[model samples]
Target: MEASKVIHAIYTDDDVLMSAVKTVKAEKYHIEEIYTPFPVHGLDKAMGLAPTRLAITAFLYGCVGITVATVMMNFIMIQDWPQDIGGKPSFSYLENMPAFVPIMFELTVFFAAHLMVITFYLRSRMWPFKKAENPDPRTTDDHFLMEIAVHNNEESLTNLLKNTGAVEINIVNKDEDAH
Candidate 1:
């Protein structure tokens, strides 16, 4: 496959980056991605990105955790080896639910957190020992980088990005075979 050229517009401040994103969107240029030192409020809205479904996934994971905890506790306390403690016989899970509340809560949070992290990693195409895809290291520290595909309008795009307060701009040719 042929290589494609892309523009990397680097901004020092997130506010400038956010405004640039709005301007770029208004001009109908497709923004490939944006990198930032930290989370920028409203950046996703400015970039017109779809709302995330991670919250829904987290809720489902929490429900699964709760169910697992309930079933495991029921089997252990009621069916497998029933023990009488505090004068309360472990004969039914429903009656002993109050005692298992802390365990249930912990497992729910644990599943939600761990599963969400794994989901995020997989969704982002990240894994252990994978090479970093960041174009610039400064973006991880103090800069914001916006990537726009160069669609035979380099001069116009460069001018627009400059006007939008880009501190540095670079054109990179990405080869499909480079990876």
Candidate 2:
């Protein structure tokens, strides 16, 4: 795995952070990550991140879930158990479908929710019982931070960050405490 030499910079407000991000992008600097206490509007565009396809993935998975539930319910209730046990008509599958709808709906929801959760975890590089990788504890509180990893040049990077209106800057190592 490639290691990053990160410079952690803190800003007081989201607007200031947004300005810094815009300046960094305009200068063509590769930003590793930005940490904020809450969602910052237009931050994704400033970072030049591609739009997420999670909604599309979720929709496709939900369709698969519905299809599976429909097929399974039809096979078991119509083909396998042909007897009209609960005063249901045995000849018509569509007519009796309303009665089997609850189970089918429940199964579809179950499959879709589980599959979507798994997809999210895998895409975010998170797994069961995995350790969290939060760099600064203050970021979760009131601070907004930006991290940039430079390639063999520190002075120019620092100057660029200062010009971008960073309030405070610190060099961070991977093993150090987050605070």
The C-alpha RMSD of each candidate to the native structure, in angstroms, is 1.5, 3.2
For model 2, residues 88-164, the per-residue Cα lDDT tens digits are 78776687888878877787778778898999999999998987676778888988999888677678888888887
CA shift of 51, model 1, Å: 0.9
Clashes of each: 0, 0
Q: lDDT of all the models against the reference?
A: 0.93, 0.83
Per-residue lDDT tens digits of candidate 1, residues 1-179? 55699999999998889899999999999999999989999999999999999999999999999999999999999999999988986868988999999999999999999999999999999999998988889989999999999988999999999999999999998673246
Question: Where is the poorest 10-residue window by lDDT in model 1?
Answer: 170-179
Q: What's the CA error at residue 33 for candidate 1, in Å?
A: 0.7
Candidate 1 lDDT at 159 equals: 100
